[model samples]
Target chain A: MSAVKQFIPLFDRILVSRAVAAAKTKGGIMLPESSQKKLNEGVVVSCGPGAVDADGDVIPVSVSVGDKVLLPEYGGTKLNLDDEEYLLIRDSEILGKFVKVTSE
Target chain B: MSAVKQFIPLFDRILVSRAVAAAKTKGGIMLPESSQKKLNEGVVVSCGPGAVDADGDVIPVSVSVGDKVLLPEYGGTKLNLDDEEYLLIRDSEILGKFVKVTSE
Candidate 1:
């Protein structure tokens, strides 16, 4: 969070860190980087002020910090910050927020 | 516009027709299909009702019908309808509206 704070998103944009593949398999065998699949899931790092309308009213974005979101297969602007890979995407490009399923 | 109405967008989504490269160059030299570069510019054909907030409030989108917009280099769901290619992309992925300058 500290590192992501240095860069802020603007104009209904969001910064996200894509998820990495599992380190080990079900058999507890370590996997190689080449075998790791690039995940479309990401964690919301930061968000910009919501986009303004014709009348100049600011609308709040649906997502917030710490929310997990489903990303479009393509379309994010790749950026490297603090040696970490991040994406600058407009909130509209986000497919949906991954809802956490909590058992009763 | 008649054909685009067959499909409707949802949640800040917009339908756009990507610009096609000219068959002839400024010098009047005809170019082959292989030489055509996919343009990132598009014209807004249709748009979804604005995304609703958690409070269920609908926000109006910035761009309207007939607006020209700059699209991300990559990212948009491609669909073919009535022999025409269109993209379904969130309005956020749109870089900006192409403003027309009228000379007095």
Candidate 2:
């Protein structure tokens, strides 16, 4: 009961929550656990109400909440809730927004 | 042998190929068949090699080769090939690029 949950995303939708795998295996030898699952790189937390245009107007969503997106190992709609497992997705399925690793 | 296939995508990635769901049911009463299994809306054909920046350079990949993308019901990695059943995804998971539905 602690997978982490606090979504919002409604309009443009986007409440990701993955990002947990850092170093499961790379030189180990035990790459079984379902092939390591994979697909982890999110953070946004919430976003939406920005895709309408055509005359309806809206189109905004550029990234804000926390920004760190980069999801696409598969895709949105996974929701679990209390058990934890968010994804939601739709900020155009966000493909880029992770630029803050600078620390030389 | 006609599920439609012709991908290309590579770097920034973007080779959708779904779009094939017009109407299954809504007023009929048949909403079973895996709940219609909705998640279509693609076209982009090919793209990639972009997104490198930070210093590496590149960072190109706004979209090309047909365009008309808009996916994210779950996400990429679901290929099949000759048998059909694509969903490669990546181009930042392409969340928007469809603006040519003029009619009158």
Candidate 3:
């Protein structure tokens, strides 16, 4: 992770490291790694400021570094750095972000 | 075409009627209709004012009504009106507009 800090994405592009799949299901049944369903979730490692509009004004990216976001099923440039795989995608391609809720 | 004037697209969306495939090649060799390749080109019938940005400012669409534009091979909602087929697509999805070049 330390080496990843040196890189920065450009122009509304986001760098994401996919979350690891759960070994067990909600029912507590252990599943093999191969059988585990690949989750479309990831954490934002790096993100650009935003895309520029026709007028040259910047349209800032909605998500920031450390945000947990939902990814599309496909699409995104795959990258490998120091044996770790990462996905580079446009900020608009992100479906949504996961928000944590706390009871009062 | 007059009936098409009654309908208007909304919000960066453009209503396009695809161009007909040419029955003859540029070389002037005649071909059957079934043998002609489908063209990814269309004429804009109607267009939206523009899409609103996050700040609520309207970002006007680039293309105008009657503009000859290139279309993507896929994506876009299909519509049927007055026995004619039209496609509803976002302005951003358009690849580019065709310009007529005339020698002075």
Candidate 4:
């Protein structure tokens, strides 16, 4: 892991990198690059303490770093850092942590 | 309200309509159409029963239909029905439910 990926998430923010396309369609759509559209699935690089609840208490996010998370395709801000595009999304926005399946 | 918007949610899926652009920048990027990119801030159209938890029980999502939700920009499959693009996102993928504010 690089030093940039070693930072801790703050509040409820999570550091994520878009998963490259597994394969492109025959039509050459190229699965819109991260610059063009929000890509799903990312390896959690960092996480925040938690989100504040209505009671003013901290509600910790369920997932942890190194987990592959699924999220909605429509939210989050796009940002570029170190020439690589990454997304800083809230943990609540994540749908679920995918369990890796190894071929039998 | 349209009849299509009156159906009940099934498992944990929430039907959503993309929130239209609040304001478009002059660059003509057009924020990538719903077909090109996943759009954020959808009005919940329907919901599902809930996700099955480790305990084998249903864990209902927090928000309800009519709720305006924020999502991660990077995840979700694109689909179009009846000539309208809509997102069927898992509630867990939703980041937060926006509380409409009435300014004085």
- The Cα local distance difference test for each model comes to 0.80, 0.64, 0.79, 0.66
Candidate 4 lDDT, tens digit per residue, A1-104? 65544456677788888886544566865654554544466787767887666556676666677887666567766667778887888765665555544443
DockQ of 4: 0.03
Off by over 4 Å in 1: A1-104, B1-5
TM-score of model 1 (first chain only) = 0.88
The 10-residue segment of model 1 chain B with minimum total lDDT is B95-104
Candidate 2 residue-wise lDDT, B1-104, digit = tens: 23332333334766556776545465665555665555668776556556544333457788787777788777676654446666767777667777867799
Evaluated on chain A only, model 3 obtains a TM-score of 0.86
lDDT of 1 by residue, B1-104 (tens): 35434877998899999898799998999999997887777789989997776667776666788987767778889989889999888876776554544443
DockQ of each: 0.02, 0.01, 0.02, 0.03
Q: Please tell me which model should have the higher DockQ, number 1 or number 2.
A: 1
Worst 10 residues of 1 chain A by lDDT: A1-10
Give the residue spans of candidate 3 off by over 4 A.
A1-5, A26-28, B1-104
The residue-by-residue lDDT of candidate 3 on A5-74, one tens digit each, is 4778888899999987789888999989797765777899999887887788787776779987767678
Model 3 chain A worst lDDT window (10 residues): A95-104
User: Would you estimate the TM-scores of all the predictions?
Assistant: 0.51, 0.26, 0.49, 0.43
> For residues A1-104, what per-residue lDDT tens digits would candidate 1 score against the true structure?
12212555546878899998788998999999898987899999888777776554787888999999999999978866557998878889999998778998
How many angstroms is the interface RMSD of candidate 4?
Answer: 15.5
Candidate closer to the true structure by TM-score (higher is better), 3 or 4: 3
